[model samples]
Target: MQIYWTKINKIIEETPEVKTFLLDCPEGYTWEEGAHIHLALEGFNAGDKPNRRLIRHMSISTLPNENSIGITTRIKEQCSEFKAILRNLDVGDEMAIFKTHSNVPLKREDKNVYLLSSGVGLATFRPLVLDYFERADNVNKIHSLNVDSSKDFLFTNIFESAPDKKFASQFVDNRKDYYEEVKNLAADKDGLFYVVGSDEFLVQNIEVLLEQGIKPDQIMLDKHARQLPEFLSSDLSI
Candidate 1:
Protein backbone atom coordinates (compact mmCIF):
# COMPACT_ATOMS: atom_id res chain seq x y z
CA MET A 1 0.00 0.00 0.00
CA GLN A 2 1.10 3.55 -0.71
CA ILE A 3 1.67 5.57 2.45
CA TYR A 4 1.53 9.35 2.48
CA TRP A 5 3.30 11.34 5.18
CA THR A 6 1.64 14.64 6.03
CA LYS A 7 2.08 17.38 8.61
CA ILE A 8 -0.50 18.71 11.04
CA ASN A 9 -1.82 22.09 9.97
CA LYS A 10 -3.79 22.94 13.07
CA ILE A 11 -6.06 21.55 15.77
CA ILE A 12 -9.54 22.68 16.75
CA GLU A 13 -10.99 21.86 20.13
CA GLU A 14 -14.64 21.01 19.35
CA THR A 15 -15.48 20.00 22.91
CA PRO A 16 -13.82 19.28 26.24
CA GLU A 17 -12.96 15.74 25.19
CA VAL A 18 -13.17 16.14 21.42
CA LYS A 19 -10.64 17.70 19.05
CA THR A 20 -10.25 17.94 15.26
CA PHE A 21 -6.76 17.48 13.87
CA LEU A 22 -6.47 19.23 10.50
CA LEU A 23 -3.67 17.71 8.49
CA ASP A 24 -2.03 19.16 5.38
CA CYS A 25 -3.60 17.59 2.31
CA PRO A 26 -0.96 15.78 0.33
CA GLU A 27 -0.82 16.36 -3.42
CA GLY A 28 -2.74 13.83 -5.49
CA TYR A 29 -4.51 12.52 -2.35
CA THR A 30 -8.22 12.57 -2.99
CA TRP A 31 -11.03 10.84 -1.13
CA GLU A 32 -14.83 10.88 -1.21
CA GLU A 33 -17.09 11.87 1.62
CA GLY A 34 -17.17 9.48 4.63
CA ALA A 35 -13.69 8.19 3.84
CA HIS A 36 -11.40 6.89 6.60
CA ILE A 37 -7.63 6.56 6.80
CA HIS A 38 -5.18 4.53 8.83
CA LEU A 39 -3.24 7.15 10.79
CA ALA A 40 0.19 6.01 11.98
CA LEU A 41 2.35 7.76 14.50
CA GLU A 42 5.99 8.67 13.93
CA GLY A 43 7.38 5.43 15.33
CA PHE A 44 4.96 3.15 13.47
CA ASN A 45 7.40 2.27 10.71
CA ALA A 46 10.59 2.16 12.76
CA GLY A 47 10.83 -1.64 12.74
CA ASP A 48 10.28 -4.25 10.04
CA LYS A 49 6.66 -4.55 11.12
CA PRO A 50 4.39 -1.68 12.19
CA ASN A 51 3.49 -1.07 15.83
CA ARG A 52 -0.17 -1.80 16.19
CA ARG A 53 -0.50 0.56 19.12
CA LEU A 54 0.73 3.47 17.01
CA ILE A 55 -1.88 3.09 14.29
CA ARG A 56 -5.55 4.10 14.36
CA HIS A 57 -8.33 3.99 11.79
CA MET A 58 -9.93 7.44 11.84
CA SER A 59 -12.72 8.98 9.76
CA ILE A 60 -12.00 11.81 7.38
CA SER A 61 -14.38 14.36 8.77
CA THR A 62 -13.73 16.95 6.08
CA LEU A 63 -14.23 16.79 2.32
CA PRO A 64 -11.46 17.04 -0.26
CA ASN A 65 -12.73 20.46 -1.33
CA GLU A 66 -12.29 21.68 2.24
CA ASN A 67 -8.51 21.86 1.53
CA SER A 68 -7.58 19.98 4.72
CA ILE A 69 -8.10 16.44 5.96
CA GLY A 70 -9.79 16.54 9.34
CA ILE A 71 -9.74 13.68 11.87
CA THR A 72 -12.13 14.47 14.69
CA THR A 73 -12.07 12.21 17.77
CA ARG A 74 -12.74 12.15 21.48
CA ILE A 75 -9.80 11.88 23.85
CA LYS A 76 -10.64 11.03 27.43
CA GLU A 77 -8.43 11.20 30.49
CA GLN A 78 -8.13 7.40 30.54
CA CYS A 79 -7.87 6.76 26.83
CA SER A 80 -5.94 4.28 24.74
CA GLU A 81 -2.19 4.53 24.19
CA PHE A 82 -2.70 5.72 20.63
CA LYS A 83 -4.98 8.60 21.61
CA ALA A 84 -2.65 9.58 24.43
CA ILE A 85 0.23 9.84 21.97
CA LEU A 86 -1.97 11.67 19.46
CA ARG A 87 -3.11 14.24 22.03
CA ASN A 88 0.48 15.17 22.78
CA LEU A 89 1.46 15.79 19.17
CA ASP A 90 1.76 19.47 18.20
CA VAL A 91 1.39 21.41 14.97
CA GLY A 92 3.87 20.59 12.17
CA ASP A 93 4.22 17.06 13.57
CA GLU A 94 4.35 14.52 10.73
CA MET A 95 2.12 11.45 10.58
CA ALA A 96 1.60 8.69 8.04
CA ILE A 97 -1.78 7.87 6.46
CA PHE A 98 -2.59 4.89 4.26
CA LYS A 99 -5.29 2.41 3.22
CA THR A 100 -7.84 5.14 2.69
CA HIS A 101 -11.38 3.91 2.00
CA SER A 102 -14.98 4.96 2.60
CA ASN A 103 -17.64 2.59 3.81
CA VAL A 104 -20.38 5.26 3.76
CA PRO A 105 -20.44 7.70 0.88
CA LEU A 106 -23.27 10.00 -0.04
CA LYS A 107 -25.86 7.98 -2.03
CA ARG A 108 -28.18 10.34 -3.79
CA GLU A 109 -31.00 8.06 -4.91
CA ASP A 110 -33.70 10.75 -4.86
CA LYS A 111 -34.83 9.69 -1.40
CA ASN A 112 -34.67 11.16 2.07
CA VAL A 113 -31.51 10.39 4.10
CA TYR A 114 -31.28 9.93 7.84
CA LEU A 115 -28.00 10.04 9.71
CA LEU A 116 -27.96 8.37 13.13
CA SER A 117 -24.87 8.62 15.28
CA SER A 118 -23.60 8.65 18.88
CA GLY A 119 -21.23 11.27 20.28
CA VAL A 120 -18.12 11.71 18.15
CA GLY A 121 -19.35 9.13 15.69
CA LEU A 122 -21.02 12.05 13.90
CA ALA A 123 -17.57 12.86 12.56
CA THR A 124 -18.08 10.11 10.01
CA PHE A 125 -21.19 11.87 8.68
CA ARG A 126 -19.82 15.38 8.52
CA PRO A 127 -18.58 15.10 4.97
CA LEU A 128 -21.73 13.41 3.76
CA VAL A 129 -23.78 16.30 5.09
CA LEU A 130 -21.45 18.78 3.47
CA ASP A 131 -21.64 16.95 0.18
CA TYR A 132 -25.41 17.01 0.28
CA PHE A 133 -25.42 20.71 1.00
CA GLU A 134 -23.04 21.41 -1.84
CA ARG A 135 -25.26 19.82 -4.48
CA ALA A 136 -28.23 17.65 -3.59
CA ASP A 137 -29.37 16.66 -7.04
CA ASN A 138 -30.77 13.20 -6.46
CA VAL A 139 -31.47 13.66 -2.74
CA ASN A 140 -34.89 14.67 -1.47
CA LYS A 141 -34.08 15.86 2.09
CA ILE A 142 -31.67 15.17 4.95
CA HIS A 143 -32.25 14.76 8.67
CA SER A 144 -29.60 14.12 11.29
CA LEU A 145 -30.12 12.69 14.78
CA ASN A 146 -27.16 12.55 17.12
CA VAL A 147 -27.08 11.36 20.73
CA ASP A 148 -24.31 12.93 22.73
CA SER A 149 -24.95 12.61 26.48
CA SER A 150 -22.26 15.22 26.98
CA LYS A 151 -24.89 17.81 25.90
CA ASP A 152 -22.14 19.80 24.23
CA PHE A 153 -23.12 19.13 20.63
CA LEU A 154 -20.55 19.32 17.86
CA PHE A 155 -20.91 21.11 14.51
CA THR A 156 -23.91 23.09 15.56
CA ASN A 157 -23.02 25.59 12.85
CA ILE A 158 -23.30 23.04 10.08
CA PHE A 159 -26.19 21.02 11.48
CA GLU A 160 -29.13 23.39 11.74
CA SER A 161 -32.76 23.34 10.69
CA ALA A 162 -32.98 25.09 7.35
CA PRO A 163 -36.13 24.77 5.37
CA ASP A 164 -34.57 26.31 2.31
CA LYS A 165 -31.64 23.94 2.50
CA LYS A 166 -33.86 20.90 2.95
CA PHE A 167 -31.90 19.82 6.03
CA ALA A 168 -32.77 19.48 9.69
CA SER A 169 -30.84 18.16 12.68
CA GLN A 170 -31.73 17.17 16.25
CA PHE A 171 -29.64 16.24 19.28
CA VAL A 172 -30.84 14.04 22.11
CA ASP A 173 -29.06 13.49 25.40
CA ASN A 174 -30.55 10.18 26.52
CA ARG A 175 -30.95 6.72 25.05
CA LYS A 176 -34.69 6.51 25.67
CA ASP A 177 -35.37 9.68 23.71
CA TYR A 178 -32.80 8.80 21.06
CA TYR A 179 -34.37 5.44 20.36
CA GLU A 180 -37.83 7.02 20.25
CA GLU A 181 -36.58 9.40 17.60
CA VAL A 182 -34.99 6.48 15.78
CA LYS A 183 -38.34 4.68 15.70
CA ASN A 184 -40.00 7.83 14.40
CA LEU A 185 -37.44 8.22 11.65
CA ALA A 186 -37.75 4.56 10.78
CA ALA A 187 -41.35 5.28 9.81
CA ASP A 188 -39.98 6.34 6.48
CA LYS A 189 -39.25 2.83 5.31
CA ASP A 190 -38.00 4.05 1.95
CA GLY A 191 -35.51 6.55 3.32
CA LEU A 192 -31.83 5.67 3.49
CA PHE A 193 -30.59 5.16 7.06
CA TYR A 194 -26.89 5.63 7.78
CA VAL A 195 -25.66 4.65 11.24
CA VAL A 196 -22.27 5.17 12.91
CA GLY A 197 -21.26 4.46 16.51
CA SER A 198 -19.82 1.81 18.81
CA ASP A 199 -20.61 -1.85 18.07
CA GLU A 200 -23.20 -1.87 20.84
CA PHE A 201 -24.68 1.35 19.56
CA LEU A 202 -24.80 0.00 16.01
CA VAL A 203 -26.44 -3.21 17.18
CA GLN A 204 -29.01 -1.33 19.21
CA ASN A 205 -29.92 0.90 16.29
CA ILE A 206 -30.00 -2.04 13.92
CA GLU A 207 -32.31 -3.97 16.21
CA VAL A 208 -34.67 -1.05 16.55
CA LEU A 209 -34.65 -0.35 12.82
CA LEU A 210 -35.25 -3.99 11.97
CA GLU A 211 -38.04 -4.25 14.51
CA GLN A 212 -39.65 -1.23 12.92
CA GLY A 213 -39.83 -3.16 9.61
CA ILE A 214 -36.94 -1.33 7.93
CA LYS A 215 -35.16 -3.68 5.55
CA PRO A 216 -31.47 -4.56 5.88
CA ASP A 217 -30.71 -3.13 2.43
CA GLN A 218 -32.11 0.29 3.32
CA ILE A 219 -29.72 0.62 6.28
CA MET A 220 -26.12 1.70 5.72
CA LEU A 221 -23.28 0.71 8.05
CA ASP A 222 -19.54 1.14 8.06
CA LYS A 223 -18.96 -2.56 8.68
CA HIS A 224 -17.30 -4.68 6.02
CA ALA A 225 -19.30 -7.14 3.88
CA ARG A 226 -17.89 -10.15 5.73
CA GLN A 227 -19.03 -8.73 9.08
CA LEU A 228 -22.45 -7.44 8.00
CA PRO A 229 -24.37 -10.75 7.98
CA GLU A 230 -23.78 -11.22 11.70
CA PHE A 231 -25.36 -7.84 12.44
CA LEU A 232 -28.33 -8.58 10.18
CA SER A 233 -28.99 -11.97 11.85
CA SER A 234 -31.98 -12.95 13.97
CA ASP A 235 -29.63 -13.19 16.98
CA LEU A 236 -30.06 -9.40 17.31
CA SER A 237 -33.77 -9.95 17.94
CA ILE A 238 -34.94 -7.35 20.42
Candidate 2:
Protein backbone atom coordinates (compact mmCIF):
# COMPACT_ATOMS: atom_id res chain seq x y z
CA MET A 1 0.00 0.00 0.00
CA GLN A 2 1.12 3.49 -0.76
CA ILE A 3 1.88 5.97 2.00
CA TYR A 4 -0.38 8.98 2.33
CA TRP A 5 -0.23 12.30 4.12
CA THR A 6 -2.74 12.88 6.91
CA LYS A 7 -3.44 15.88 9.06
CA ILE A 8 -2.47 15.96 12.72
CA ASN A 9 -5.64 16.60 14.70
CA LYS A 10 -4.16 17.14 18.14
CA ILE A 11 -1.07 16.68 20.30
CA ILE A 12 -1.46 15.48 23.87
CA GLU A 13 1.32 16.03 26.37
CA GLU A 14 0.85 13.07 28.66
CA THR A 15 4.06 13.82 30.54
CA PRO A 16 7.29 15.78 30.12
CA GLU A 17 8.79 12.97 28.03
CA VAL A 18 5.69 11.50 26.45
CA LYS A 19 3.41 12.92 23.74
CA THR A 20 0.54 11.42 21.83
CA PHE A 21 -0.33 12.52 18.33
CA LEU A 22 -3.94 12.30 17.24
CA LEU A 23 -3.98 11.81 13.48
CA ASP A 24 -6.91 12.54 11.18
CA CYS A 25 -7.60 9.75 8.72
CA PRO A 26 -10.20 10.76 6.17
CA GLU A 27 -9.85 7.40 4.39
CA GLY A 28 -11.10 5.61 7.49
CA TYR A 29 -8.22 3.20 7.84
CA THR A 30 -8.82 0.52 10.45
CA TRP A 31 -6.32 -1.62 12.37
CA GLU A 32 -6.16 -4.43 14.92
CA GLU A 33 -5.62 -3.91 18.65
CA GLY A 34 -1.79 -4.27 18.73
CA ALA A 35 -1.06 -2.89 15.28
CA HIS A 36 1.32 -0.08 14.42
CA ILE A 37 1.80 2.35 11.54
CA HIS A 38 4.86 3.98 10.06
CA LEU A 39 5.11 7.75 10.32
CA ALA A 40 7.52 10.11 8.58
CA LEU A 41 7.83 13.79 7.96
CA GLU A 42 7.81 14.81 4.32
CA GLY A 43 11.35 15.70 3.33
CA PHE A 44 12.77 15.32 6.78
CA ASN A 45 16.53 15.92 6.74
CA ALA A 46 16.25 16.64 3.03
CA GLY A 47 19.90 16.92 2.05
CA ASP A 48 21.44 14.29 4.34
CA LYS A 49 21.67 11.05 2.37
CA PRO A 50 22.18 8.69 5.30
CA ASN A 51 19.34 10.09 7.39
CA ARG A 52 17.21 11.82 4.79
CA ARG A 53 14.13 9.63 5.19
CA LEU A 54 13.63 7.69 8.38
CA ILE A 55 10.19 6.29 9.07
CA ARG A 56 9.38 5.42 12.65
CA HIS A 57 6.97 2.63 13.56
CA MET A 58 4.50 3.93 16.09
CA SER A 59 1.83 1.78 17.74
CA ILE A 60 -1.79 2.86 17.43
CA SER A 61 -2.84 3.38 21.03
CA THR A 62 -6.53 4.17 20.55
CA LEU A 63 -9.35 1.69 20.12
CA PRO A 64 -10.43 0.94 16.54
CA ASN A 65 -13.78 2.61 17.05
CA GLU A 66 -12.23 5.97 17.74
CA ASN A 67 -12.50 8.74 15.13
CA SER A 68 -8.73 9.17 14.97
CA ILE A 69 -5.61 7.01 15.21
CA GLY A 70 -3.18 7.96 17.96
CA ILE A 71 0.52 7.25 18.61
CA THR A 72 2.04 7.90 22.01
CA THR A 73 5.83 8.27 21.92
CA ARG A 74 8.53 8.84 24.51
CA ILE A 75 10.98 11.51 23.51
CA LYS A 76 14.68 10.88 24.12
CA GLU A 77 16.85 13.58 22.65
CA GLN A 78 20.01 11.46 22.48
CA CYS A 79 18.48 8.49 20.63
CA SER A 80 16.37 10.19 17.94
CA GLU A 81 17.03 12.87 15.37
CA PHE A 82 13.42 12.87 14.14
CA LYS A 83 12.09 13.90 17.54
CA ALA A 84 12.73 17.53 16.67
CA ILE A 85 10.42 17.13 13.72
CA LEU A 86 7.74 15.43 15.79
CA ARG A 87 7.93 17.92 18.64
CA ASN A 88 7.56 20.80 16.23
CA LEU A 89 4.45 19.32 14.58
CA ASP A 90 1.43 21.62 14.76
CA VAL A 91 -2.26 20.75 14.77
CA GLY A 92 -2.77 21.11 11.02
CA ASP A 93 0.57 19.71 9.88
CA GLU A 94 0.46 16.78 7.49
CA MET A 95 2.55 13.67 8.15
CA ALA A 96 3.22 10.64 6.00
CA ILE A 97 1.31 7.64 7.38
CA PHE A 98 1.72 4.12 6.10
CA LYS A 99 -0.64 1.21 6.36
CA THR A 100 -1.19 -0.60 9.65
CA HIS A 101 0.82 -3.70 10.50
CA SER A 102 0.42 -6.42 13.13
CA ASN A 103 1.39 -10.06 13.59
CA VAL A 104 -0.19 -10.48 17.04
CA PRO A 105 -3.84 -10.10 16.08
CA LEU A 106 -6.50 -10.11 18.78
CA LYS A 107 -7.78 -13.60 19.53
CA ARG A 108 -10.16 -14.94 22.16
CA GLU A 109 -9.47 -18.08 24.13
CA ASP A 110 -10.36 -19.88 27.33
CA LYS A 111 -7.12 -18.77 28.92
CA ASN A 112 -6.58 -15.33 30.37
CA VAL A 113 -4.54 -12.58 28.69
CA TYR A 114 -1.83 -10.81 30.65
CA LEU A 115 -0.20 -7.73 29.11
CA LEU A 116 3.16 -6.36 30.25
CA SER A 117 4.52 -3.02 29.16
CA SER A 118 7.04 -0.38 30.18
CA GLY A 119 7.39 3.34 29.50
CA VAL A 120 6.21 4.14 25.96
CA GLY A 121 5.64 0.42 25.48
CA LEU A 122 2.07 1.10 26.62
CA ALA A 123 1.36 2.32 23.09
CA THR A 124 1.32 -1.24 21.80
CA PHE A 125 -0.61 -2.97 24.57
CA ARG A 126 -3.11 -0.22 25.46
CA PRO A 127 -5.66 -1.01 22.77
CA LEU A 128 -5.81 -4.65 23.88
CA VAL A 129 -6.74 -3.59 27.41
CA LEU A 130 -9.49 -1.29 26.18
CA ASP A 131 -10.92 -3.84 23.75
CA TYR A 132 -10.85 -6.72 26.21
CA PHE A 133 -12.68 -4.73 28.86
CA GLU A 134 -15.52 -4.16 26.40
CA ARG A 135 -16.31 -7.87 26.54
CA ALA A 136 -18.23 -8.95 29.64
CA ASP A 137 -16.57 -12.35 29.65
CA ASN A 138 -13.06 -10.91 29.65
CA VAL A 139 -13.57 -8.50 32.51
CA ASN A 140 -11.90 -10.58 35.21
CA LYS A 141 -9.55 -12.69 33.08
CA ILE A 142 -7.36 -9.91 31.72
CA HIS A 143 -4.50 -8.43 33.73
CA SER A 144 -1.88 -5.77 32.89
CA LEU A 145 1.31 -4.27 34.30
CA ASN A 146 3.03 -0.98 33.56
CA VAL A 147 6.58 -0.54 34.90
CA ASP A 148 8.07 2.91 34.88
CA SER A 149 9.48 5.67 37.05
CA SER A 150 7.11 7.41 39.39
CA LYS A 151 7.12 10.61 37.35
CA ASP A 152 6.89 8.78 34.03
CA PHE A 153 3.67 6.98 34.90
CA LEU A 154 1.64 8.42 32.07
CA PHE A 155 -1.98 7.57 31.23
CA THR A 156 -2.68 6.14 34.69
CA ASN A 157 -6.29 7.27 34.54
CA ILE A 158 -7.14 5.21 31.46
CA PHE A 159 -6.42 1.90 33.17
CA GLU A 160 -7.50 3.04 36.63
CA SER A 161 -10.90 4.10 35.26
CA ALA A 162 -11.67 0.72 33.67
CA PRO A 163 -14.73 -1.07 35.02
CA ASP A 164 -12.71 -3.93 36.55
CA LYS A 165 -9.75 -1.77 37.44
CA LYS A 166 -8.28 -4.15 39.99
CA PHE A 167 -6.90 -6.31 37.20
CA ALA A 168 -4.67 -3.45 36.13
CA SER A 169 -1.38 -3.07 38.03
CA GLN A 170 1.12 -0.24 37.96
CA PHE A 171 4.42 -0.84 39.74
CA VAL A 172 6.82 2.04 39.87
CA ASP A 173 10.37 0.68 39.48
CA ASN A 174 12.49 3.64 40.34
CA ARG A 175 15.22 1.39 41.73
CA LYS A 176 14.80 -1.75 39.59
CA ASP A 177 13.28 -3.75 42.41
CA TYR A 178 10.33 -5.05 40.39
CA TYR A 179 11.82 -8.45 39.53
CA GLU A 180 10.27 -10.35 42.47
CA GLU A 181 6.75 -9.17 41.64
CA VAL A 182 7.27 -9.89 37.93
CA LYS A 183 8.44 -13.43 38.62
CA ASN A 184 5.49 -14.17 40.88
CA LEU A 185 3.00 -12.77 38.34
CA ALA A 186 4.21 -15.04 35.55
CA ALA A 187 4.28 -18.15 37.73
CA ASP A 188 0.67 -18.84 36.76
CA LYS A 189 2.22 -20.68 33.74
CA ASP A 190 -1.18 -21.01 32.05
CA GLY A 191 -1.56 -17.33 31.24
CA LEU A 192 -0.92 -15.90 27.79
CA PHE A 193 1.57 -13.05 27.97
CA TYR A 194 1.99 -10.19 25.52
CA VAL A 195 5.14 -8.15 26.08
CA VAL A 196 6.27 -4.79 24.67
CA GLY A 197 9.21 -2.68 25.73
CA SER A 198 12.88 -1.88 25.07
CA ASP A 199 15.36 -4.67 24.37
CA GLU A 200 16.73 -4.88 27.89
CA PHE A 201 13.32 -4.61 29.48
CA LEU A 202 11.83 -7.24 27.18
CA VAL A 203 14.74 -9.59 27.73
CA GLN A 204 14.56 -9.29 31.49
CA ASN A 205 10.81 -9.87 31.61
CA ILE A 206 10.85 -12.75 29.12
CA GLU A 207 13.69 -14.43 30.97
CA VAL A 208 11.85 -14.17 34.26
CA LEU A 209 8.63 -15.44 32.70
CA LEU A 210 10.39 -18.41 31.13
CA GLU A 211 12.16 -19.23 34.39
CA GLN A 212 8.75 -19.26 36.06
CA GLY A 213 7.57 -22.03 33.66
CA ILE A 214 5.83 -20.00 30.94
CA LYS A 215 6.12 -21.72 27.60
CA PRO A 216 7.55 -19.98 24.54
CA ASP A 217 4.32 -20.51 22.60
CA GLN A 218 2.36 -18.83 25.36
CA ILE A 219 4.28 -15.58 24.87
CA MET A 220 4.29 -12.93 22.14
CA LEU A 221 6.71 -10.06 21.96
CA ASP A 222 7.42 -6.74 20.25
CA LYS A 223 10.69 -5.22 21.35
CA HIS A 224 12.28 -1.98 20.13
CA ALA A 225 15.20 -3.32 18.16
CA ARG A 226 16.36 -3.39 14.57
CA GLN A 227 17.14 -7.08 14.56
CA LEU A 228 17.04 -10.06 16.88
CA PRO A 229 18.21 -13.68 16.70
CA GLU A 230 15.85 -16.04 14.87
CA PHE A 231 15.28 -17.98 18.10
CA LEU A 232 13.92 -14.86 19.77
CA SER A 233 12.15 -13.53 16.69
CA SER A 234 8.42 -13.74 16.17
CA ASP A 235 6.33 -12.64 13.20
CA LEU A 236 6.47 -8.88 13.53
CA SER A 237 4.26 -7.43 10.81
CA ILE A 238 5.94 -4.08 11.32
**Candidate 1, residue 75: how far the Cα is off, in Å:** 0.5
**Weakest lDDT window of 10 consecutive positions for candidate 1:** 229-238
Residue 36 error, candidate 2, Å:
0.7
Best by TM-score: 1
Model 2 poorest ten-residue lDDT run: 229-238
1-238, model 1: which lDDT tens digit per residue?
A: 9999999999999999999999999999999998999999999999999999999999999999989999999999999999999999999999999999998998989999999999999999999999999998999999999999999999999988898989999999999999999999999989999999999999999999999989888889987778888887777766
RMSD of every candidate to native, in Å, equals: 1.0, 4.4
TM-score of each: 0.97, 0.85
